[model samples]
Target: MKKLIINADDFGYSAGVNYGIIEAHKEGVLTSTTMMANMPGFEQALNLHEQYPDLGIGIHLALTTGKPVLSNLKTIIDVDGNFRNQAYYKGSFIIDEQEIYDEWKAQIEKILATGIKPTHVDTHHHANLFGDFNAIYLKLADEYHLPVRNNFTNTDSNRRTTDGFIYTMETVIQSSETLEKVFEEYNSVELMCHPAFIDKFLLNHSSYTYPRTEELELLTHPRIKTLFSNHKTIELTTFESI
Candidate 1:
């Protein structure tokens, strides 16, 4: 049976994002989300998490788009304190390995401090996938003993989702037939999605804004529900499940 992990990212970026992620998990087929420890709406996200205990939570190991959880991170952050990365900003940047490690540790420790055990672990802008950061991240995951989303394993050299079968909102909205083909072809797949209500923060901080709403609508559609209806046929799962 194929296992599909539908994970919504950026749970604590803002109030609007928190609302969308919570709404998706509670009412839609969304089974999991990755929480940002250093984001603006982190507290609100944690509070909502208490309400939906079934939604699998994971640490969104952040090194981008905001200030570091640890103070005085000179190497990783710019003069303004924003990490050299943004939500939609994707490229290579020089990193101080030690500083980034400490920052991620702080991020994960912040989550554990709340007594909310994460279901798994992932990253922001996939910062962990580059340079010596991958080694640092994997070491942290092992140390924390948390299952990582897509670690060093590589079946496809592209995206880091399960077997590299990550799908986009454009594909989902434009053609369900394409998705069906994908669903039939893969035994395991991790579909990453971002759903949010855009505010000034998202608009200014991310190159991706309005499309987030579109993603939210597509994932919550009733027709999409029918696809994962039979448990015996396909396992709708999270990293915590298996």
Candidate 2:
């Protein structure tokens, strides 16, 4: 059977983002989301999860955004003490693998401490795929026995992931024809999206803004709901189920 998992990332970024994610899952085809442990809205995301028990949750691990959960990291942090930005990951700056592992472990543990069973693991800005971070990413997944978002570059025979991963937000959100093609092409796929109702925090912090509202509209549309629900071969699935 063809399975599709529509996962909204950055679940704990802000109240606007948290509300938008809940709306998408409740009113649209979204089946899962990943939370950022160190984000401002982390507590709100957990409370929202209590209200929507069936919305599968996962961890969106970070090395690029916000402050690290663990203190005194010599390698990953910038001079100002916040974690390095996305540009740092894209460049050739050296990172300590042990720091990556420890910080991520703390992130996972923080989520687990809240008594929420996370459904999977992924990275913010797909940062875990850079350099030796992929190995640590898979290692944590193995240690915790959680599934992961397939970036198509990192592979582990024992890891649990969908058959394919699809991105390119602008094209998918604007064109239902393109979304339909995605379902037709893969037996199982994870489509990553960031849907939000813009607020001051989101506006001030994130560069990829306005398009989120477009994604929210597309996701919650009745036609999009039918496209996923009534499709003959496509099954809406969650990482926990897969």
Candidate 3:
């Protein structure tokens, strides 16, 4: 039988986001989540993790769209103290790899210090794989001996092309043949996804907010479940389970 590991991202983004992740875990097939240490409600997410010890928790490395955990802001921070935004804005900025690595190590240490042995590590906005940043990310994961979400999920292509009204309604579903090929080629894989409902708050506050909501729906879709039945066959193991 194939096993499945459903993950919810952005654990500490907000109260609403936290609530949504918990709900998805309780009612949906959510098996894991990535925590944003710098988010406003990070403490709340950590608290929730304490209550649900079984919930696979990992660090959501945020170098692109939020505040940095380390004080060496020169490496990750812009003119402001906040992390550089990669989700909505685009610009050619130099990444101080050493400072970035130091900050990431500090963040991982902070998460581990919280007493929750992180199952794995992933990044917000997929910044870990962005440009030269991936080297630092891979190095950290290797040092920790933790699995990372390295493979792409079809949900990435399920964005809304028409009017912004419809979400995953335009999901260009991928072929199972292709999905299988990818899994076979990659061996251990981490299909990352952000499955959530895009409410008024999300719409007003988030960037690529619509696509994210669509991503959530696609992840939970019955068709996706059926297609990836027994996701373990594709090496869909949790970050730490590996």
- What is the full ranking by lDDT, best candidate first? 2, 1, 3
lDDT of 1 by residue, 1-242 (tens): 76678889899999999998887777677888999999899999999999999888988988877888998688888888877755323465565689988999999999999999888888888877666678888789878888776745654344324653474644643344655566676766677899888888888788889989988887777776764563355577777654
Q: Which digits, one per residue and each the tens of the lDDT, describe model 3 over residues 1-242?
A: 23335677888887767777776665444678889887776898988888877778988888776678877567567788888767423556666678878888888888888888888787877776666777787778779877666432223333211111111222322546656554444433344556565556556557756566555566566775566554445433355555
Best by lDDT: 2
Q: What is the alpha-carbon lDDT for the whole of candidate 2?
A: 0.87
How many clashing pairs in candidate 2? 0
Model 3, residue 3: C-alpha shift (Å): 3.5
True-vs-predicted CA distance for residue 89, candidate 1, Å = 9.6
Write the residue-wise lDDT of candidate 2 on 53-110 in tens digits.
Answer: 9999999998888899998799899888899888877768787889999999999999
In terms of TM-score, how similar is model 2 to the real structure?
0.94
Query: Which portions of model 2 show Cα errors greater than 4 Å?
Result: 169-180, 183-185
Off by over 4 Å in 3: 87-91, 152-189, 197-205, 210-237
Q: List the candidates' TM-scores in order.
A: 0.87, 0.94, 0.73
The candidate 3 region of ten consecutive residues with least summed lDDT is 159-168
TM-score between candidate 1 and the true structure: 0.87
Instruction: Indicate the residue-level lDDT of 153 in model 3.
Output: 29
